[model samples]
Target: MRLHPDIPPGPLHEKWDNCRFSNTLVNPANRRKYEIIVVGTGLAGASAAASLAELGYNVKSFCIQDSPRRAHSIAAQGGINAAKNYQNDSDSVFRLFYDTIKGGDFRSREANVYRLAQISNAIIDHCAAQGVPFAREYGGTLANRSFGGAQVSRTFYARGQTGQQLLLGAYSSLMRQVAAGKVTIYSRREMMDVVVVDGQARGIIVRNLLTGELERYSANAVVLATGGYGNAFYLSTNAMASNVTAAWRAHKRGAGFANPCFVQIHPTCIPVHGDYQSKLTLMSESLRNDGRVWVPKKTNDL
Candidate 1:
């Protein structure tokens, strides 16, 4: 594809603002007509559902967790990345985008990475407003830390429970919507498949995990934030029940699965103690900066 000269090319900072204003919008009155279904309670799913409902859409959110709070995102021990540059160090959008692209071994789409970089700032602000109790500096400003290959202190975290804190923020917002009746949250439900009518997603087929009864749900559009299929390895950092069923069913229904083999293995998880060891506990990569990484020279040493 040839580049369009009229498009902005200076930096992502300039491109997002230019493109956002150029996009169309649905009037507030018409926004109520669109019903959205989100089938996951992880950070992505819950946050997306809450934000969508706040925008006046008739939303229905589902999760297999006994509560939305139990989504796999809650298992995330590390923090989220944002480029606030509060440390006045060498942090910036391009660097974060480049790090993510290089970290993923260049398999990720540049457009998606760029957009993630743009919205990352808002994620931090949104979380702060929800009173997540993030670790803060003496001056009461939010604290930052380094993670992985990033050089700057840009990763905002809580005391060894960043994922839990952030998920709570998103969940709080979701609960507010549930209380208002703007969003109908169905807990302990598993999404079986998406229903498409005449080439567009119309609803979904779900199963009540507790009663084992199947139900049909109809909506204008459905969103599958059910998360990744890292569990396909049978032994991974993923939750015990996490599977590719939701995304796989969607793929079979026409949502293309891209880069299915892209898996990033963190190097510092606890070594398997015995053959019966069930799962590995990740000593967050954040610990690597302060702790030294080592391995035995002999094959039998471990």
Candidate 2:
């Protein structure tokens, strides 16, 4: 098997810059002729579809829910971490990168983590400009909250509905693209199989959840932004619609899977007091900021 991780040659601080300068660009004149399929209209998928469509590409955006707003990303709380140094707390890209690596127990790729930190500031700025209504101080500066992993207060939040607000921003952009005729959204469709031609992923076959009809769509590229597989377990905190199917089908068609064990989870949740509960509800870890956590001193205390 052959794989290209696409790491650019440079110092860690310069690698993201190197990639931006070295990557090939798709001409705007020819973009309209290329069809790109983005599945799952969560924050990642919706943002990607909107951006690609804004670049003049013909995009087909698919989602399992009846509306993009219903995607599971809406369930997320807490806040987004960025090294903006807005709080004068000595925050920087390098610091965020190191913290992320350490938080992952040094198992994450340095390049990828560094890249994520580098772009975080831009994400926050874009989100704010999109009217996400993040909490701000009395002086009107964006408020910063401290989260579990980091030492500084760099998390930008929108009260307890950060994910919902962020998703709304992305969804608005996606709908703008749809109105411009650059993006076509297909709701209530579940991606069943990735269609590969000549050893290349060229399209997908999705099932209409309501009518049970199979529809085939061919595109120049396919993006699978399906969320986690927590549902794979009998009981989970994950959204019921979140499944491993789309990703697994793509994996069978030749996509690479890395760090399959790494997934997002919130430990501070409403506890399961009994076996009768089918699923437990997640309480935002951000609550740690203003509340004191109390637990039994020993197992016998319960």
Tens digit per residue, CA lDDT, model 2, 1-302: 68778788889889889889888998889999999999999999999999999999999999999999999999989999999988898999899999999999999889989999989999999999888999999999999988875888899999999999999999999999999999999999999999999888889999999999999999999888998888777767888777688988999888897767887777887777787876669888887876758579898897
Model 2 segments more than 4 A misplaced: 295-300
| Top candidate when judged by TM-score against the true structure | 2
RMSD (Cα, Å) for all candidates, in order, is 3.5, 1.8
In terms of lDDT, the poorest run of 10 residues in model 1 is 1-10
Model 1 local distance difference test score: 0.85
Residue pairs that clash (backbone atoms under 3 angstroms), model 1: none
Q: Could you tally the backbone clashes for each prediction?
A: 0, 0
lDDT of each: 0.85, 0.91
TM-score of each: 0.91, 0.95
Worst 10 residues of 2 by lDDT: 286-295
RMSD of candidate 1 to true structure, Å:
3.5
Error (Å) of candidate 2 at residue 143 is: 0.6
